[model samples]
Target: MDKQPLLRNLETNQPCQPLSPQLLSMAATAAYPGAPQAEELASAPPAHLFDNVTGYEGTTAGGEERFVPPPLSTAEGAGRHEPHPQGAWSIPSITEETAREAFIEYASSKCCYSAKPAKEMVFRDLKSCNTYRYRLESFTESRSTEWTSEPYKGQFVDSSAYGPAPLPWSIIVEIPQLFQDNIEKVPVPHTSSIKGCHSCMAMGRRACTNCTATGRVKCQFCNGRGYKFDDRCNRCHGIGLQCCIQCNGSGTIPCETCDQSGQLMIYIQLTVKWKNNVLESVADQQSGLSADLYEKMIGQNIFTDEQVRVSPIVTFPEIQINQASRKAIQEHQVQLTRTSLVIQQRQTIEFIPITQVYYEWKGKEYNYFVCGVDNKVHAPDYPAKCCCTILCAVPGDLPMASGGQTVPPANMLDKLAGYESIAADGEERYLPPPVYPAYNAEGGQPQSNQQWSIPSISEDTARQALIQYASEHVTYSSRPAEEMVFKELKPYNMYRYRLQSFTESRSPEWKSEPYVGQVIDSSGFGIPPPPWEVPVDIPKMFEKNKKKVQVPNTASVKGCHKCMAMGKIPCNDCLQTGRVKCRMCDGRGSMLGNDTRCNHCMGNGVESCRSCSGHGQQKCDVCQGRGQLYFYIQLTVKWENNKFEQVIEQQCEFPTQKLSKVTGKELFSDQQFQVYPILGFPDPRINQISQQGIQEHWTQFGKTSRIIQQRHTVEIIPVTEVQFQWKNKEHSYFVYGTENKVYAPEYPGKKCMIL
Candidate 1:
């Protein structure tokens, strides 16, 4: 039975296509030795699954028009002799002076390192190794398929209404342009059908696995005991049982397979993905430098070629370059062609120069490498490290005495005597002498004449604020504000500007559900209007809203898949038995170890299933007991108002976030479809912010979402810093915004205990 053709050409009555190379190889390996039979090749999966169609058009099994990708073209002048241009192949080395400066800068950047080595080291030798890098990029497209289903709403069944279903590989789908990374999913034409939901076996609900169809479980809170610690259990009210939460005491849950519609719309989904694959190979330089370092360096591009399929270079001076090119091309084709179709191929060769400088310092040899067009240096080891201590002395200090005997000050003599004794006795008794600057008796005074436009609150209002703050924090006391002194208040004004861009965007998707009673819109049957072209009422600007509208003419009705047109299905809870074990007695016909008859079951071992009410069947939920569904495409329109704000930095020590919470005085306001930046504002920073906000909003959201309206406003938030003296100590508090909110980080009353 397996050795038979799954499909045949309608005209010739022969096999539709030949077996793939992979399938043929598998058959060759599985065939018996000396056997001449061709049955093994025919036993493989259908040829369409792996067909390599090399055409732009084809016909589906149902004679419907389909799209087929064309084969890749060969690169022009491939595998031909290409002469190198004069002076383009030369590798230049950097001068010694340039190498020294780069090394000196490198040494100076390290901590506790001296530049003596860089200055004194003599150049011994310099080696230059030029390496070549080969890179290949293949842009390809691949396809995959999967079976998906939705609730069987009254949707048009394409296969039932049209002709036979098309093969998966033969379905027509519009492919996006090649060499770009993209993903698309297309439904196979004439493949959609209605089928019974296999999940619940056409049942609208499934047995509650949590309670095992008993509708009740042992009470978790009371541990199945009627009483708890000599008292009746409150959770179960002495019944020692609780209704199943999953089934809501019905012993069954709505079937998820059919979405409670009791049917599904089954179809094959084809996913086409376009991807760019990159592969690189570098020629072995043997320069003792890491290949990864050369990769970061930009090399001279001696050769570049791009085409549908690139051939390996055969006439290059470097044998390694020719070999690497051949290997890369073969590997790319072998790896990508098995699962995907190559649309284009690009290959290039780069020649990077590397210089290794050998130098001598302090009778030892040291080496450093310079790489790339930017002359990046890599030096891990450098000689001449210093750990010298710096000392600061007062002016006009005593000079060193004759014979290197230094004359110390009287205070220094005491510190030195203790230092020597501690060192001789290994004791930590010595202390470093402290250096102090000459103290000035006169100190700066606080500014007293500054006045605030926004005055401080009255004593009564401050008291109420203290009480309100105390009520929120259990540990805080309200007694401090009553006695604290009022000090000077200075206001610092902060400016803020906010810009809002309100945009509306629409996205469309296919949706289906069990067909109930719904108005059918056949006007939108053909190609629906583009999202931007569709006319929709724009709501008030800056207010977010979302609405879904069905596309006209896209709706169709199909039979229910889950219940198979049967309005009802067997109840999963009872499994068509219409009965379940009694929960009170655990199917023992009695309670308390079979000593007493169970009151709930009247001595019966089983009770009727609550899910179907003893009928042993349930109404299909997917089709809503109608066993049909309606399918259509829907457009979701979403409105979003994006907000951008900028606040000028204030010189004072006020928190910027605090200003945002309070109301401010609006200085300037503008609203339009596309508002221009403010030209003449009192604060130059506000004008700059306005321009930046508008430009940034347009760049970030203009492409993906449609802009409906733009509005910008500037506000001045007044902030005051108040300084007061309390118990000979200075304290400060801030008052900001039009609301007069206070920010007192160091309130003097907070440090005092009221108790």
Candidate 2:
């Protein structure tokens, strides 16, 4: 896989020779079969999984390049390949044997250490001292230079940030005004115009059909003769017929119960209106942003009406309850009970606001990150200077030079790489030493002494993940925390980790489970600790004390007894006697039948509260019938973590930068990933304190890299010494190039070397 994108490089700006297959040759025809030869080059190691990417781990004695390509006379007017900074050093094609011979000849005929080759040796031990570094810088102002930031959008319902909130509903608001307003908005026929139409006693008819105009009808019992034989029709009293029962013997019966038209009037009270439910979003009115749906309008009245049903028209997800919300429903006075001003069909909106800041100072550029929500800097307290922090220096297996007196066991070559050459007593000196000089890149500017970087994850976010991991891993606790968020509980969570071991053999044996331990959180327990035990009972006493807080109870009801838990899943049918008016007669006592009160509901028209069985409430079950419970508690359990879920390693390829104008001393710090054993190590204290195998990761990318000017040395051949044996005689000569005076080739080197 191409890891360039994944691999974060230090970008120390060291120039390297490109790998090429250019063969070099130096041989004098068969005349001098002396097998004379020259030229060999050492190539740099390929990119590999080295402990450090910068490769600035060890202090090397050969601090600077020892080769210088003689200035080219390109314009003898002829085009020529640009001279490699160290090209000429491979000159005359000096072979390894020739170099070896030259070295032996130089050592034997010259001074100092012996030239004899080191004794053949085989070393078995391989060690690596890898140091981790972090870069942190602070600025007064800044803007993103080259970054691909992501804006995460979220949505939540909060009481409106502006205007009023919905709450404190009244249970008994006057209905006269509302009644009048509703009448005007939606008018009905006037009661005075609803005159009744009366008719003849015969069912609204103008005349009785049985009697016609006479309004009297012949008695059916006596026929037309008014006689029934023996008793003279005792029906008609002998001579005539009985008066007409239909018209009561009158010519025209009057129906005074109603007008001849028989029209009747009706009345009703309008229960619902537009103001009954209002849904306002940011677009409609200034509001706040939230991650989850929660009650936003606080201290506002929840208008209710007797005529209207009890259920709210709108609802919000119950996540967490703010303290102010609880108090608002409890302490705030009810504004109206006539009708509930329900929130319905809310129009939610969300946006992730990115604060892009820019600034400039002195002649340099940088940025100041003022974070959102948390109001913190992305990288706070970062240093404002270039850093060449030494990760960790380790001397690998290096060859030891034979000390005519005593041979050193260490690899002289490898050891020499981390330090400048120091002259030995008499015959001692740093090995491979051209003895290059150290150049201060940022002159007059203080070099960064510490190593730190931004974390791949924010401390707050990481803390939450760690706490969750620890909760699963630890074997001891009254109740290990779960689904925990930062600052939700009092105090903090800290733990001592143990590396578990399980036997794997013919008979696999169980080894460890979650360890058992008690959380020393004074506030986590339901019972309060004694005054003297306050400090000791708290976990991370010093650190958490500052952030210690009281979390509101999100588990149960608070505020209005009628609504129960604010507007959050509060009880709609709070009364065990949950009841409503009978639907018949429109809750009116009277019905069309017999124009009398309804017998089913005993004329009340309101049935027994079905929800409450006519009672106001059932047992207070959520609160255990107590109506209250502790606000918070730490869940106790034994941590059963058998293995680590995961370990992350992240790096950035480029350093972030920006332009700024504010001034302040930047802060820098590093997060140490040192593990300390509490029950497993021999010396618990020592094992915990010693950072031997710490796997520290510089996860965060620098917000801004400190720009520094480093001093470098370039190679040049002012004069080259050429020696050879010709015609049985040894002779030396010199080749002087172009005065080679103060040449400038935009060379990779910073200083000029006289070769």
Candidate 3:
């Protein structure tokens, strides 16, 4: 016997080594300050002394202008244009307090065009006379602004960052860690159900109409069947009677009530509906409508309070007539008539006066100006003027004149002496009415028939149709008659009469024989057999198989051997308890005296069941090991063309004092600003566009100045110094101080210098 060779395999495992301290420190240093440190000195070479190429000296060999430049920075050229001057004082950066004061001052200033109140004249047209009266009104002031100094009002505040100062660096660590631990696990949802069912036609056992829907029928042989019953008949054998031929089996005839169809005709109500309700108040407005009628039809009472008043201006009432009739006209009466009538009406229009007077609402002063009305007149006799004035016309006749000389009477011969008539033949004869010839009774002659001949049917078609028809109708007994007739009636060939046939008999020419087969084989030439075959049976085959499969056991997998090497066996952690705890009663012993579960197997008893984990089944930690956890996010977007529009109107209520209580100084400028009227530069365009200036008043303002000129100047401050001072200090400065320039003085080295 040969000695068996021994084989053994040994395996050793080791863990990865950590990096050295020096290399780790060097990597940490390189990553310090992130991208910012690299960017600052990015274009310069490393600062190590060995990398320097140039020698050190007090100055570069090429001097100041030739020195090389370092890389550009983000802040380099930002304020290149604004340079500080050598001696001027510089403004310090703004502080929050100073900004607040400036903003407060801005908020207190008033607009320049505020209006003031004043007393003004209004004219009214009365029944008999025109009246003029004065009333209070508002007008715009030349300089209406009011201003006060205060603190800043325009600044934005953020509320989210208002907490105590933070150690800004710590946010980088805490935010991500907090979010990662709190993530929620979401579950998967069930999907919609899908299923299908087969379709089939309806069928059932047929019912016998003779017995109606009831299965039993009367026995005809037994008649009323009080006692002695007859045996069921075999073709009525041994029975007294059989089923009637007319009624088909049972004794009763077809129902005379429903005819044969077994259906009845009767009237039935189809549908009913209620009418709409009418309130009593509404019915009162429409007097012809009755609320009681509506209540009866609608089955409910309606309550209403307000009476709606409808205007005749918008809706008119229907017209009424007393009577109407139509009749044949046998006679008529005619008459001529005349009448005189007069009508009068009053007309009014919006009236704007030629001269308008104005006064201050809280002051004694008043002012006046004019805007003329426009009018037109087509009749040359009436003069066109403003409608503000009244025009009265006097009714009087013109004086009848013994004013001019009279002429002589007319002589008839002078009017008619030269007139002559050209045609003396009784007046011109009228032309005869145009004649239209009558239609001829025969219309037109018929055309000759010699043009084209009609086609004739083939002899084969005629004979074939006759043969088919005779075959269908003739019985077997009639065949002999048909054969005799057909043989006698069949068409024959004709030949011209001649005596030469005797020579053919003596020496005959060759002749051909005809085909004898009754059936035709025309398939190759494409004419199909006259009667085609109908397909009868279609065959189908199917095979269905069902089977079960088995998997073979193979090699054993490697277990957690590291735990085994420590002198302690590897525990089955899947059981969730150490020592695989007794698998029955889940490690609890049997109650009373016996093991409630198998003693050798522990509480689980068996193994690997999906539930009970088979020693059987335990919780799977992988799905916690149950299954996978899914994540989902629900998004809701309310869309309208992806855009929404809203129209908003904002309103605010403010305190207002009565005009009567406001003082004159609050309404208009103080008397000190008032002055005597004076002439100012004239606006030629105003004069040119005026209607009166274009017509009668052109010479009053200017002659040669069609005044196409377009500008004018109105000085708010008068010639008096008191008025100028009262208006404002700025106004005073403009009128009294010497002129000064606002720009800075120039210097040699700098581009701009302010003084």
Candidate 4:
């Protein structure tokens, strides 16, 4: 019979491939750091060995059973109720003088208002209408299990070696105190088992995929052309191939699944999660005040109850409050009990008062509401009206005539002639309305019709603005902006279109290769679905995700191609000679001085090949020396959100890039699984771009990938370009977006280096 080839102990007869004593010691120590020595382990009793197992415990006296906590004792008088308060719950009303003062203060806050209406308007009546709010909290704890694994480092195995492993849920673990939100992970005792690594089949190494087991790979520097720009490539020295970096020219890598130890420790891990769930509701007062305003206010705590589970309040005067509590408790129990354990529940009731104030100005009537203990006001119509030109005037320093009455300057009186104001006697009065002229007060043609115009700032205000701006920017100098002549203020507005294409796509490719001990995934073994037909759940938009699955009916075994079924290949290093020319003597059989014998080769001129250890052949990496191959198809599912944005060109100096950092008022928004192009948008450019984007995405990605979802939106970004003059030079700044964010790129005072 032919001599059997060596497998695990290939280095036994070859000195060139001798195993290192230090390496073996380190590997053994790392595998079992606290394990007893081989002799001691062999002599130790079975019971002692089991006791030493990590995260393992002996079986309980009873069979597998879920552990349940003892029931909580019910508190006495848990459902008792208190009688509702008599009379309406309302705060004292404000006096007429106080209301008038509030209106005057509100008027003074505006830059353009004359404050005449506030000072003269008479109070008709004061109506007080008040509202109430309620809240509930539920705290819960939940438990779950999942399979987890780690490298087997001689850990105790309960299955097969010891006996059947303990059930996952039956494993005992310490439960944390309830009510507080927390999480804990515990490994189920006696559930761990040892399995041979499926990746490398206990060989501790795998063929390097990058080099295809040849110990060399194409040079990336020259794209494997051996030359770059008609010159010899320095990276690969014109050889076209370089030693594989991944395997360090060994053509093999340590198995990651087993951490190079060739075995895996598998166990079940239990996760205990604690959570606090809260629900709230409010009662409507029909006071015409916005319900949302009540959210910011705190109310009086009329009733309080704490128990394992509290009953809904039935004695409350408001039917809505009682019904809201009942609905909340029922909903929490139905939703949470399905997945988590309810630890404790607490509920409380609060009363927030809202009062609406009604007052009349001239002959017409208007009202303002005061809410909560802090007296927050919501007055959309405050009676006082003004023109946009007032934006340029200094706040709180309105132009005044004699007797404290606000009046326009003689120069502006002509401009205010066309506007009319209503007085307290229900008659028309001639009052100066704040006017923002296109030209300066000195009279000149407007700078740009495309630009928005605001009143020019006074020299003092300009100086203060420069000082504040310079303080914020470390590289700025305030001298230039402060010394320059104050000029005109111009504003510009721009719009942009943003299209987001969120797609979930699947691509299938035939992947046939030699198999080792990989577990066959037959989950997709039925009729394969078309790439586009595969149903996949949509994930969060704009998030990139990827997953792979084995294609159905595409797996098979075939003869190995690299070795031609021989399971071995001639060693490339020695070229099947089993020996290589001695490096010390250069294959001359003698060293320097002619007669000096080659000690390394003993004058033979050749040494055993280090790569194959003089065996003339190496195990085929393609089949892992198995002489067969496993062919299959792999499907890759990718979720990607492609965002395309285009800003319409503007006729102003505002930087388009600045709009990206700030959010604008969304003019139009649409989202769907697959969206149609937008139509009838106010801006024709927006409609055109929407159509172009949809078509381009379909043509580019739709052909190769399935489209999952798409969302597109248009926004009117408020861009106010303010142009001003300083020291006879013109400068501009931008006040953009609803937030009124300022962006001044070319401030007159910048680039000043501080020594």
Candidate 5:
């Protein structure tokens, strides 16, 4: 087992390391005053010396806390008072007193004592029962905190499936007349549903007039040719014909009423919803919204102006729009919008009671804390004493007879003081006590010894005897436990935002195109018409001229030629053969005894032509070599490039905004002490005394005699606590919150007849 360190350094606020056991000082202090007796000083068992020293079955393998001896209680010396146990002073007194006087004649006529003269002396203990006072001033404190809030308000936009046609598109609408000029056609549902389309050629029953009921036409791609590029008309398989365009080889057209699926499309409503966030504020549980927030909240775009407002919402009247509330005489339309604001405020109080105590005991005054009272004394220092009463009498003896009791000598009785005694014959008798001991410096009580009397207390044992006497005066008193509560107002402030909900969904405007006949137009396409006979046409210009010239000739001969610049042709100087016989030497081995040509041809018997070096022929200029002349004509045709119009869909949109709110709250509690009314103690004179005795003596005993005295009081105190709660409520609202939405539609492309 391990033990926690007892003390910590105030500066570091950390546990102080344990010093060597040798560092520990003497345990005695003002708190533990008065050394123990010799027997009590015996070595204490290790179990009592420190925690974990003995009876520890725990294993040391685990880490343990270091134990440091508590710094010898230096706090004891300061503000030190008499050493006492807890609740000792607070213990009440439980003692009562009784006194009775009675005089009675002896049962037998002859009496040994005087009945009438017999007196009952009652000794009353006087205790003011006044107590020490105490005041427990309550000390309370609280901690507060604040922070910025995160806005969690926002709009929830949901688009659900169309229901019952709130607003819908219709398939039974006017359609453009394909391949026809200047026409919009509306077909009868009953007839057009079953009959073939007029121009489209529906269900195989209707023969295509364009294809002559054969559903075929000439193969324009191959011009009725069987092969690719006029080789074979693969597209028509040599038939030179193909399926008709109008019938698409089906010999029939699709009906528009059924949309070619044999089933008609049904229209339903399309609903859009705009809602606020459902979650609550993280800082507080209060709702950031109020019924009034919904008032005048409907903004533009939620509902169309054409779609009459016919009481859309009535369940919450506060949120309902009041047409009469419009101050502008209802001339202008209402535009609903929502926004939130933060409302802030600040609020502070103190509760502490006064308390004090005063007390006195044994002629000594103390500010607070009780030690003795209630008709009882806490004299742990009272010395024990044993005194005997002696009845004095004149030195006279009764006649020695058979019925008489034995008596001691008058010389022995002469030492006695304040003792009363009697013989069987009713005559008083006496016996003497031993001489008293010498007086000590204190001179409180005298000591004497006698064989027939109680043993005398020795001076050496005076202190021990006084302390032991405590058991005789010790007593107990009771008091009930108590509690108290003190409170004060603490001011606080808070800020927050509120949110209001208006119309979840609405349309501010409804736009529709009026019915009008529209003709398919391709005239804007810039396509020109082509004509062959008796027709006006545009002709392309051409500029051409021809010219011819004769050739110089053709030759197969070699070098120095236009086509053959070098190589493979024999040198002209050497004719068809390469050897020139060395012009300088004229075929001789040497000229004038020197082989000049040999040096020129490098010892080879051949000569190379500079121009056609040693080759026989010259190059021909005409035709470059042995060739022909070629000419080509370049032609470019130009006209207007057809520009076709592209089909594109148009787009439109509306803008809207979302909103939310934030909130916060605070609360606190702390403990403090409270002091109630002061408590009471018993007065010795009024309260009862259970045990009492008195002693008077002689035999050299001084005229002075001593008695015990004491007094005290108790204080009452209890614990208490204080608490507080604060809250700031607002609402969850929105800004820029309208039936914010977006929608788009597609239109089909129209076509005109081919011209």
Candidate 6:
């Protein structure tokens, strides 16, 4: 059955490489390959269950290219030519249960030296010496016209020159120590290691979004005001001036309340966040570029051709955090004496696994090694078919013919065509020459805003298309018909309807009233009306004048003509009806030193009815309750220079007050910082140290034993391999690619071995 095509790579025209079964299982389970720690389980040999383990436990290495799949092709004929699968180096798959069992068993394996429990095996720092004593060998003088870098006694400047001298390469080797059998039996000394760091909490640096690197932003609310204004005044129409509605007079209206202070209460709230991470170190070296040190400079092609081919001895160490002390840790030291090594010429380049040797310098551990820095620069797309070699003078060796090929340029790009073709997408077209107007018979053209060549009208189809295009392009044009617009139609219709309502036509009789009322000047019979009104007594006289008569004391009722003629009431205090507000009581009932009635009640034999006081009636406080002092008022106030004297029908109020204050800095400090851990190994401390393998035999005094051999050389090369493992009776596999393939041992079984 045809399988679905793997995800297409964006650049290369290939399906994404399938994940190895091991990786697929890992992805599904979210588990990672961690170093085994159990000692007892690992010490149990797998040979007991499976006599022959065909697979080797080692790291694979190779170079890889990034792949990006091309877009899907539609040509039916091309489908027939699908390429067969080309598998690459990959990891083997294993079930979780199998991997777990394997890890535990591996961790429990006995130490390689003593065959003792691995769990009980402890790591100890090895002391190293930088000084060395060596007898001078016959130095060979080597020369080349081209200059190369060398150590100097003078300060180095760009113009510094290379001094003539015998080939000055030096090499040193660690005299691998052979520990006595009793060494394993002896207990390791108590480490008592201690480390110190600044005790203060780390300060985080937070980004300022508001100021955008300046650490500040403008206040959006209140425009940065500490407070805001809300209430608008109600009196004088908010203009601080009033005009009378009755006579259009400009004066203060006598307030029935506090006589017009014209003030109103207003209220406002603010919010803010704290800028806590202002000076904190929220992140560190994680932001810096990272890679495995040994994996990078040593295993990877980080070295230049001169640094590699001339084969400079690399001295970087594998340093890790000491689990015991939380301080840096190192194993042993390695020194390469110039006389002890050689740089062999090779026709092809390869990857070499980094040997786990330790060194020490300044009381720290470092790992160092010597390897054939194969001519990486000399390799081509198909691997080097020809060889380029440079032979430096070697001590104690015959002065071999003093002739050899010169070193090639570091970047020999001429040999590689794959990278060049990949970069060429295609050539672009050039534009044609511009057309010039013909010089017609004595042609000198006149310029006009209106040109005769322009068409006055367009074809209907063309015109309709242009109109539609214009309507679409000019989004805000109101001339576009409603049917032409693409949005829902209701809001537009409502908007147009509202606009039409503003200019609606009016009817002629809309403002005219249907009925009217008039003012009368006369009261009942021949009585006078109010004093503010003109007297109508003459109009009611009917051509006859009645004799003027004095009102009897008993006829002193309100509105009585005789009593009014006597001028008994104060006009401001009374209703101009012959009655008066009693001076002794101020219009309230009961006068002092009298019968709570009229003054004459106790002395002149004139008594009040008491129920009505001496005036025969009481003023109502509840309607003032007797109805004596009652009056109605339609209250008016000037609001924004307009008179609003209408009696209030209803009123409501919303009460809110300013609760808190917010500053601009607080408002802009709401953002937070995120942090992540640093990747890669830190620098080492020492140049040389010693580490004795526990299971491996070590050299004893004066023993020519193969197991204890000292002088040996191994050629290193890089190779790619596929990875697989058995899980649940099934094989899982994966190929090494760009992200995974790194330098490993040349010997698949020995170098770079995991077990």
Instruction: Indicate whether candidate 1 or candidate 6 has the larger lDDT.
Output: 1
Query: Which is the winner by TM-score between candidate 1 and candidate 5?
Result: 1
Q: List the RMSD of every prediction in angstroms.
A: 40.4, 46.8, 62.2, 32.2, 65.9, 55.6
384: Cα error in model 1, Å: 9.6
Question: TM-score for all predictions?
Answer: 0.38, 0.16, 0.09, 0.37, 0.12, 0.09
lDDT of 5: 0.23
Supply the global lDDT for candidate 1: 0.63
What value does the lDDT take at residue 292 in candidate 3? 39
Model 1, span 516-594: residue lDDT tens: 7887554344554444555678887798898878655556666655566676766767777889889988898877643
Q: Native-vs-model 2 lDDT?
A: 0.25
* lDDT at residue 266 of model 4 (Cα atoms): 64
Full-model lDDT, candidate 3: 0.20
The Cα error of candidate 5 at residue 682, in Å, is 85
Model 1 ranges with Cα > 4 A deviation:
1-92, 96-125, 152-157, 164-181, 359-365, 380-755
Question: How do the residues 114-165 of candidate 6 rate in per-residue lDDT, one tens digit apiece?
Answer: 2121222221221111111111111111111111111122322322122222
lDDT of 2 by residue, 1-755 (tens): 22121112458534322222231112111322332222111111111211221212221211121111112222234432321112111101222233334334433543333433211111111111111111111111101111011111221212123323211121122333322223111111111112222122113333333454354445455554445654556655654445655566664444333333333221111122323222222211111223222222121111221211122212211111122222223221133222223122111112212122232232122332222222222322222323343555333212312211121212221112122232212222212212223322222322222333311223344333333433321121212112222222121111112121111101101111111232223322444322112232223211212112222111121222212322222223532335667767668877754455564675777777565466554443333344222222111111111111111111321111210111112221112112222223322342332221111110110111111111111111122222333334443322222221111112111121212
Ranking by lDDT: 1, 4, 2, 5, 3, 6
lDDT string, candidate 4, 631-678, tens digits? 555556778777767777678866565565567766667776556666
Please, what is the whole-model Cα lDDT of each candidate in the order they appear? 0.63, 0.25, 0.20, 0.60, 0.23, 0.20
Off by over 4 Å in 5: 1-214, 218-220, 223-230, 244-248, 259-755
- Runs in model 2 lying further than 4 Å from the true structure: 1-580, 592-604, 621-755
Ranking by TM-score: 1, 4, 2, 5, 6, 3
Model 4 clash number: 11
TM-score of 4: 0.37
> Please, what are the lDDT tens digits per residue for candidate 5 over residues 260-287?
4422211111111121111111111122
lDDT of residue 261 for candidate 2: 35
